[model samples]
Target: MRTFCVTGFGKKLKKHNDLLKIESKEDDNDEAKNLLVSPLDFDAVIVSGEHDITTGAIRLLLKNEIDLMILDHFGNPAGYILPCGKSKLIERHETQSRISSSKALCIAKAMCIASMINKISLLRSIQKNTGVDIETHIERIRKMTVQAESCLEINSLQGFECFSTNEYYSALMKIIPAEFNFTGRNRNPPMDPFNSLLGYGYGILYSKIRSAIVKAGLSPYYGVFHASYKNQEALVYDLIEEFRQPIVDRVVLTLIARKQVSSDDFNVTNEGCFFKNNFKKKYAGIILTRLEQEYTYENEKKTFSEIIEAQADILASAILETGKYSPFIYR
Candidate 1:
């Protein structure tokens, strides 16, 4: 199963029998001719920018039980199309019942710990190559993790989590090259190119994790760590914490450090920085490829996509009291 991402203006998607055809109205003739016409092999289709999609394609996607994620102009996930009436009620009941329990707190703390560890690992990897002294920052993050684990309430845990995350970003800024000019993590309208890429990558990751949660027969809105809000995928947010640094942050930092991307790839205005349409497509492709790379986990090699699904299932099992939940800590 693969993910198909459609970007650019005047893109049209249609379903013809078992085949899905994507036609780009752009002037590039070769690009339109190279579009993939095999929809049966796709697990999901992510559509970005202005495009027209046929009802037949939607029907085919639903028939195949494939997810369709739609992203806004700024790369924020706007909505999703998923097959209805497929979730099991018992699983949702278990999920709700466990939300306010000690099990929930434990899972939240574990996520925070894993996030801190991954951030430290990333810093250490950077230090090794750049020969920068990050030991002080690493120890600070470790202390914050210990403090996070001791919290009995969700509010306190969130506070410590934010503190640790801020500290991690501050330390990260020191090690990265001065060209990226990454002062701190900003999201509202990501002020710089680095934050812009991070936000866009995170949105893509959120869509992937949300799909995994739904496939595991769990509700994405009802979460233990993050409170349910209108149209919010809180469970996805909770589960995505441990992966944010390892996946999105690492990818963005690598791109900046290697000078793979430039300021010309983005449009900077008084509002904030935004990736150009073509550059956004290229960036999305990189993240998708990263998600598919194989890695060793729990004595077994698995792709990040498979690991995400496994983690979702583990969370479901924890809710059902069939097993305990453990966050995926990057080694």
Candidate 2:
């Protein structure tokens, strides 16, 4: 996938209009480095903006294919999910039979299974020639599978319902403290900044992303393990969720802990709350850089994007019923 970084002014993309478009600002880039997407094309598009962007600056995004999203100053989302209108633009697939939600879930379950199997395979790869304890790894898989199952729960009524704050942050509470500050004390009630409006903002973006992804017909289940819905794209959720525990959540906490990002990064107005451009750029940098960096998985190190795409592809294969179902549960 092509990664386009939009910096400076008057930056115009030199690539052919037909190729994939990925990684950009909410508006045009005057001097984007030339790239070739080839046959596969750009997988996704991320738009980062400092403040209010030109009213129609986002029009270019609506013309592409694949995922598109706009990030705000506070490291939150502002709900311009149409990164590429052509991607969300659907033509009736008269060639192949369309699957219902139940059918899709069945396939998605298999896809999740494939992802889990791949994880095990990758773990073995991580161990290298030294070898790993199969029994121990099996146990870990079992435990992680249980957690994945919970995330995959099919809550039709509530599955599609989104929260205003980052729900993943709430999920993390189960494993870690809702720290008032990254390394500071937690008050008795614990109802201050940690659980304040900032949290609420994260939740809003999370839900919007989920809603938009589902509406686009991309499986959210395949991406992350969140509450599942019948007609939603659960696959991407299956894929992205793996990063949530250690990636997005950790970054947010660290920002708070180091005081890199504070309440000042965000401002609430009657028009609705928004983050500062610098804040969005910071969070986006953190997320992208973290994802690009290598981390140990199953005792072996790999880039975050590698594992993420693997999970997503596994779901794609499963939906196609190319193999059995599986789930991805990280250790």
Number of the predicted model whose lDDT against the real structure is largest: 1
Q: Tell me how candidate 1 scores on lDDT.
A: 0.82
Indicate the residue-level lDDT of 55 in model 1: 98
Model 1 residue 235 lDDT?
A: 84
- Name the lDDT of candidate 2: 0.42
TM-score of each: 0.93, 0.49
Per-residue lDDT of candidate 2, residues 1-331 (tens digit)? 3333232223333334544332344464323344344324444455444323332334443444434455443324445444433344333222112544554555444434444444444344334522433445544554554444444443421232222112322333332333433222122222344433334333333433443444434544343233343454444344443344344545555565466766666554544345444454445456556556776655677765555555444544454445544444554
As for candidate 1, its clashing pairs are: none
Task: Candidate 1: list runs displaced more than 4 Å.
Answer: 26-30, 85-91, 94-100, 228-231
**Model 1 worst lDDT window (10 residues):** 85-94
- Assess candidate 1 and give its TM-score to the true structure: 0.93
Query: What 10-residue stretch in candidate 2 is worst by lDDT?
Result: 157-166
Runs in model 2 with CA error above 4 Å? 1-45, 50-153, 156-234, 270-272, 297-300
Residues 219-328 of candidate 1: C-alpha lDDT, one tens digit per residue: 88778777634568788899999899878888987887788987888888889888887788889999999899889988998999899999999998776555788999
Candidate 1 colliding pairs, count: 0
